[model samples]
Target: MHIPDGFLDAKTWITTTAAGAGAVAYSLRQAKLALEPKRVPLIALVGAFVFAAQMINFPIAGATSGHFLGGTMVSILFGPWIGALVMTAVLLVQAVVYQDGGITALGANVLCTGFIGCFVGYGSYMLGMKLFRGKGRAIVAWMSAWLSIVAASAGVAVLLAASGTFNLATALTAMVGWHMLIGIGEGMITMLVTGYLMERNAVMTGGGFKNERLSRNRA
Candidate 1:
């Protein structure tokens, strides 16, 4: 979800920029810890794939279009930190080279779609796995992805409301309403990609508590 320039007031943009900067910094450190040598090239490839996929926006209800967010897919394959990093790179490329998202609102976009999206999806997946004892991994992945998109849209709604662009109630209704529909597409793509990529053995191995290897294993 790209916030166009002028949608947010100066104060909102400044505050979000600071928050986004902090999130990016913390995520970078987490990425370093999560990184594996063999995964670097795959991470780059995922980044490229995300970048390409985002370009083809599918028509949604009304004239608006929605695209694959890719946060859950990346996080499932790598980790949340790497997913965030990859999303950041994708947003950067879209803003600078493709001019799809505005430059001034780049930080806000990253905050909503990159930071919040990645963490929410990945965190929910982990929590669901724990709660379900990893039995319905695919279902968990779908729900995680669906919820993440909705949450990210809520974040955007709050930010826009904070900017005084719209009342909180109205913004929440509009943003959440549209994104709920959009998130169906996100859930489908995330579930398919994650299911296709995850090893059958890895799915079974998730029951082992203290299995740090599962965390490190790339899909």
Candidate 2:
């Protein structure tokens, strides 16, 4: 969900930019450690796939077209940090060349869709994996994506409230309500794509998958 430039005021834009910068910096450092040589190509391909998938949008409840956010899917396949980085890149390109999103509102979009979405989805998936002893992967995936979308919507709601675009109650109700419906779409896409694309042997590093290239790190 990319917020247009005029949607957020200057103060909200500045605040979100600072937060997005910090998150992107942290994610970059973590990505350097998490990604292995063999995994680089795969990660790039997955990012491209996510980018492409996002272009195909279906109509939602309020005449707004919702598409695959792909944050949860990426985070589950890779990790939160890498997933964040990938989304940031996607958003950057969309803003710069494609004009899908606004440059001034880029930071807000990144904070909501990139950082919030990736971390929430990945964190919940890891927790679910632990809770279920890794049995119900599909369920965990679905839930994680569902939660991530809602969380991102919440982030947007908070920002809108802060910007005085709407009162907290109204913004919260509108954003969360729309996203609850949107999240069903998100969950379905995340589960289906994750099941189809993420290979079992794909290395998961720097989040919860400790088995990933431990020897390489030592070396």
Number of the top candidate by lDDT? 2
Which ranges in model 1 have alpha carbons more than 4 Å from their true place? 202-209, 213-219
lDDT against the true structure, each candidate: 0.86, 0.86
Give stretches of model 2 more than 4 Å off: 199-219
- lDDT by residue for model 1 over 1-219, one digit each (tens)? 888888899998888888888889998998887788998887898888888777778889999988889998898889888898899889888889878777778889989999889989999998998799778988899999998899999999999999998899999999989988888888888888888877755344444555755545544
In model 2, what is the error at residue 60, expressed in angstroms? 2.6
Per-candidate TM-score against the hidden true structure: 0.92, 0.90
Tell me the TM-score of model 1. Answer: 0.92
Q: Indicate the residue-level lDDT of 152 in model 1.
A: 90
Worst 10 residues of 1 by lDDT: 201-210
lDDT of 2 by residue, 1-219 (tens): 789888888999998999899989988898898777887898899899989988988888767878878899998878888899999999999999899888889999999999999999988987897799768788899999999999999999999899998999999898889888888888998998888875544544554445544633421
